[model samples]
Target: MSNERAKILIVDDDAMNRVVLSDLLSDEYDIIEAKDGDEAIGILETTAKDITLVLLDMIMPGRDGLGVLEVMNEKGWIKGTPVVMISAETSTPQVERAFSLGVTDFIYRPFDQMVVQNRVRNTIGLYLKQMQLSELVTDKIYERTRNSDMLISILSHIVEFRNGESGQHVLHIKKITDILLRALLKRTKEYKITEEEIGTIATASSMHDIGKITIPDEILNKPGKLTKEEFDIMKQHSMNGAKMLDAIQFFKNEPLMKFAYDICRWHHERWDGRGYPDGLKGDEIPISAQVVSVADVYDALTSERCYKKAFSHEKALEMIRNNECGVFNPLLLECLGDVADTLPKELNDQRTSKLSDADFEKIARSIFESTENDTENIIYEQYLTEHKKSQFFASLQHGVTFEYTYEPSMLKLHARNAKALSFPTTMAEPENNSEFWTIFGRENWDEFAKLLHDPQLNNDSFSFNSEMLVKGKKCPCKIKVQQCWNRRDPENPELISVYGCVEFFK
Candidate 1:
């Protein structure tokens, strides 16, 4: 591997410096030369493959190294390319600016060959190490992604399998979300969301209701009325969904997990603060939550559930229109109008449940006939909102089962669920011993220990024992504390972790 030639791009107007530097490192690397920043960018604009490390000079005539960096940032052609600033200008401000613009490291003028090689090697190695760590993390995430995708597919299947909605509810929601989010991007000039990000977000959105795994199939598939308490318990699904997402932190930045977490937690929240568990109102909710809210409600209203028949797109729009300012974001409601007719058609909502005025009133009348009626419903009178809770719950009744929540926390996971799940219990000894941890982890032991020591084992009950952790048999890799060895695999690369164990090739 050491014999492998690293590709180095040299961008400089200085012939002498380039010659000297190239002569020193050319044997160890395949040196690519560009006289100026514009030329360097032009080279990169075409087939500049495998060009890893860039030794960039600060001052050039037409477009300097800084200008090249600016172009690179704009194009975003490369993800984590390392550019080291090689310059005569060693002033504090200039060096600071270079570092600020994401330069990997700096090498000054009158630089020694040994020092230059060391800095170049250090930066390249570090950059390579970061790339490897990212790959490993990505590999771990990809494995989790595959697992999540299967789990979500199963949940989605459960919804359609029993409820008879086509196996495409989630697929449609994913598509609609993509369309609207892209439209919003175009309209609002929002952040640059990549295709990968969108794909992952859509995929993750599919599993937002996987917490229904914990819900009983009877209540989930029931074609009848759930008592108020049962309905409240049903609400816990959202929290359950969020809890499921939090359990596998390996998928943190994966868009689907993020979308799933948001939808699972806040899908039930009202635009007004009247929503349950956490009475989050309006924009205080996550934008992903808001987007899914619009998508989810629109799908549910137009599709049949067990308790009621589906409203036609026109009626669905009317309901949304009635909702106007309070229930749905008025702007999003307006956006809904743009896609209204085509959406159901696109989603292939062939089993559209036809409903009469009686059916509407059957749903609408629940609040009116019940003693729970207060000024709140009367205030939103024109809206005629039956139940945000019911809408979510009835989704299951229609076989549109999604994951849900009992409460949302400051971090967005349901604190009740996290606190409940995070509680540790002692693992029973198994012959293999690994199975004990494989099933129930050291976390469980720590929690049990905490509870043993303290009557109340709260979230903050256990202080992390760094030394004990280091000495543990699991020997889980901690590459950051020392250094990382890069792996070439993009999908699932192994990260070579260097521990703090003191050793050398003596």
Candidate 2:
């Protein structure tokens, strides 16, 4: 489509025909010649991705044009590469058959050079436009998918963080659910699940424990075993999570919402009619919920939690098979065994990779803007006000801007400043970060911490002078801080996070 010439492949047994066709369009296109179907098939196998169009001859020695078309169809090259039959065959049945086999156009024998050239040009142009449209659609779909995954990750991480579970628990559950569902598909057709349904179910698996957000922190993070009464309260999270999705009103009927509600409420159920909230027996539980249940239990057993040490991969698998955790669908249990060897490595890889603070904030901002709750709307407005102020201050000064959240203990540096200082854009647990401590020095950090903790200065904007190591050189800088708070409860405001900046001064 650009100035670069499109490559056209001409396949014919007659050398003269090839030369005639090549001479007709060689000025505007690069041409490749094949004397027979075998040679044409060989060229296509090696270079079909680059070849724009195929000028195939119907009657050729050793594999005819139709044979080549069949092969192309089998290899899936026919979809992207257009084929025009430049053949002597005149029968309607043969022409129809070639069209059925994916020939875009058919030219009769002794064709006019002008007609041939025009048809070839038009076909290439049409196919190019179609390909471009396909690519654009694919890109849009990919972007939507990425944003959906980011939001899901953010929501799941919030629940996991609050529940004191490993950060990778949601990811592990997602990956394991996907593997098991795919394996189940191969093992039987009892569920009649489509590939698209598999994806939806796997994605919804991340929200299986979303209800835990409603649980009290004391019960959610208790280091000791929960009492029966406390455990019963904890188990209510499933129903609570379902209620959250059910209350969304607008998207209640959407497939993802339905899947999320099912998984949230039913993932904790068991196969033997002994599981909670409404003990669904066997297939009474949706396959989506069943698969996530297995994934959740497997991840819980193999991952170290606040109350228990991690079991080995083998031990976890043994426990599941022995029904020590809970009874599961037999098909899913077998699916688990099928993927047992890959689970440990997959989970380990997930542990090492985490979302950056900038990404988390971006997702948080998006979620805040979209939430329907009045309380969240108030917080969102407050966040927007602070964010605008931060942006204005950053624009007015040549300094490093940063934000620190108290509960998660994350410090995020401005993108440019982070690059200039050779520091991570986001550092979790700044007090424990060696790089942060090295830059600010422990004494300076302690003073800063003390200042932030002082009740009298809690809501005040303040500044202090400190020496910081910048690129191995000590520089005196003035640091300004602003404390952010959730004023939803006017009488009892809560400190949420802090925003600050550092400017080097002589």
Candidate 3:
């Protein structure tokens, strides 16, 4: 629609027909030619995003125009790029079939130059306007989403501040909920969730504990275990949170508000009907609430609080898997296990300082200074690349892997490896785990610690061979360790944690 010429793909088996169409439109538009459907599809596959319109012939040798249309439909290119059919086949069935396959217009054989140019111009113009409208709507939706997330974050932080929390709880819950939902989608289509819904649910999860704002400070931040009456009073936050949302008459019917209400009211409910506040069981609980419940419990366990010391990531996960905290949906528990290895790193990243909205805008402007109009396409392409990379790594991983956080002194093992080795999947304090000490003994631990701290050893990495006391017999193994450091303050580098693996010898 701008002064720049739009690119049009001309597909036909007949060389003369392709030349005629190209000559008619090449004055106003850039024309790309393809002799057959296969060639056209190849071009489209690589440059579909750049193509503005496709002039396709109905019949050709090997994968005709209709076949090309089918491929375009499958790949979702037809939605954004307009397709016009150029052929002599004007029968109703053939035309109807082409239309059904997403053909925009048909220019009959012996095409007049003026008629061909007009149709091409109209189709491209119409699609351009439609695309512009779609982008405007998308931008509006994103703006609204950002505003809602900001308000919810501010309100959630207020509640956390009042309750004496570290203020990262809401962010942790949101991230965990998103990870769990995506993992759940991979495992089953039972929930019928979309990428957009995953984001909405994660945003709504922040308000899950908003009802705590209504509670008295004494009961909310009790230093010790609450009395029976105080516990009963404490359980009312879920219902109170729901009631608060219900009081907002204007947004009562909104989907996001409804999600927030469901999560707030039912996150405390358990899968076995043993939980308080209405005792939802099994699938009776909403998926959003179910996900937030697991996230909330995991954060609660791993986070330090007034009443209890923080458990290690390994210990918290072990507790949930064993149903020590409470019963959870088996599928959700499996989803939790799937993301277990990445959770600690993801949460730690969240703990890092985040860019403010203005900072984000400044960075975005700088990145888009040369190609401001292509910002959306650039982001979409990056997302596709990252998604492919995630899938690639997920499939590529093998053997056992584990991570240890230094401050928390928690060690987490691959779930399958933990089960195979007869070791707890997660250990809060490895030194305190009798089974852990039994397998790798205190003497080996002392030697391992000394090696890790030795100045001569590499600061980032060290390896050693040791014998594990397995089944009252010693088995030789190799241990590899990689240290993670916090370099936020370059002058005072801090050791954050280590990730390592063990290879047992036969």
Candidate 4:
């Protein structure tokens, strides 16, 4: 059914019957006519997918409404398309059969126009509402799944980046786990895994080693076997990973969170029960944990570690099959074997696709610098906007506004309101702070210089009436100045600039 109008099929042997219904509904719906049950069946067989409602006259010359209803049921069109039985016959048996055969409503000959219109409107509204609700649910599921995936991707990258592993480590685990899960689903009915659950397992597998972020680099990348105490500290990552996710209030009771937490905290647990962080034997381990544990082990074996070179794909599979890593679910092991030949190809592709550390760092830094620059540009733009507004307002005041750079000893006259305060704009200003002071009376210049240099008065500013010398003539003037501090290195205590307004003291 379209958002504009629903499609309605009007079926009757008599032309007048079809004409009456079409006249009533053609304004609100698209009307298609079938003169008999056979014609209706032909239309339904060809176009039933889009047809929203069927108006079937019960008593027809041949293959009447009951027969059409039976055909619709057999064709499985009854679920999506609702049917209404039109009857001139007042018989009870035919109407009962029509209802049992899934007629949505019934209308008699000499139809009440209002009753017919209301029933058709209500039936279409109900179906549309149900369809809309189903679509809303599907969209919500997709949005939640996407958000979950993005969150895991970001967090897993942090772990892999900190651990100095290739960025593809998590990706490889996810791929292997997906292959293993699908193979398991096909090989046996023992695991009641659905397509949705398979996706969850694959996504959660990427976070199996997320706890490694908490492990110190020295211990994590040690080239030799860890000391017992160091190994204990290393093992805490699983619990640490779980605790980290648990702290996120939004993930509370979310199934993905549970799957991720289980994978993180228990991927190390073994079938025979010799693993760390609460070892559970056999099926006591979560299915998600079991699947990811296998994926993590395969990747670890085939990936280069500080302590050992990467094993060959064949050797890695052989080691797992031989239970060299630890005991695993026999069912999963069988599934792994079924797909083992393809695993090397998948892993080879991942390895070939891996970004070098230098390349990864360069790319990561580019992204960070771009974002930082964008933020800084926005702040600088806002500062300029406010500064312009302040300058505009300051321009309206009756004085000469100037900004002085302390280090370079340059003065920029922003506005001049009096002839007594005139300075030559084309001429170079004073070359340094000492030369700048020569424009004022010696005693007043010395006092102002002391104020500029005072540590305690670094940010504090003052305004006073003083005698200023212009063209070697002393005149009373008032000045206000405030020091500007360097924002980048605040502790350096270098005065960056000073802004002031000056006018005649009278």
* Per-residue lDDT value at 383 in model 1: 21
Task: State the local distance difference test value for candidate 2.
Answer: 0.81
**Model 4 Cα lDDT, one tens digit per residue, 1-506:** 42767899999998988888888888899999999999999999989988989998998887988998999999999988999888878778877888999988888888788888999999889887888898999999886665565556555666665454655788898899899999988988776778888887888887888778667655675556999999999999999888766655444678778888889899999999998799899888988899889999998898876567889888999999999999999999999999987887876676412233343333333222334465434333323322332433334456666555554455655322323456532112454345446656568867776787787877666677787667767778787767666545556766766666777665
Cα displacement (angstroms), candidate 1, residue 129, comes to 1.0
Which segments of model 1 are wrong by more than 4 Å?
A: 1-3, 12-14, 34-47, 60-64, 74-80, 169-311, 314-506
The C-alpha TM-scores of every prediction are 0.44, 0.61, 0.50, 0.58
Rank the candidate models, highest lDDT first: 2, 3, 4, 1
lDDT agreement with native, every candidate: 0.59, 0.81, 0.78, 0.75
Candidate 1 residue-wise lDDT at 344: 67
What would the per-residue lDDT of candidate 2 be over residues 322-394, giving only the tens digit for each residue? 9998999888888888888787887677652345547656655664555657955763454344344434353
Give the per-residue lDDT of model 3 (tens digit) for 297-321: 9999999876678999999999999
RMSD of 2: 10.3
Error of 3 at 265 (Å): 1.0
Worst 10 residues of 2 by lDDT: 383-392
Worst 10 residues of 1 by lDDT: 404-413
- Between which residue pairs do clashes occur in model 1? 204-256, 209-403, 237-404, 237-405, 238-404, 238-405, 239-404, 239-405, 305-398, 306-398
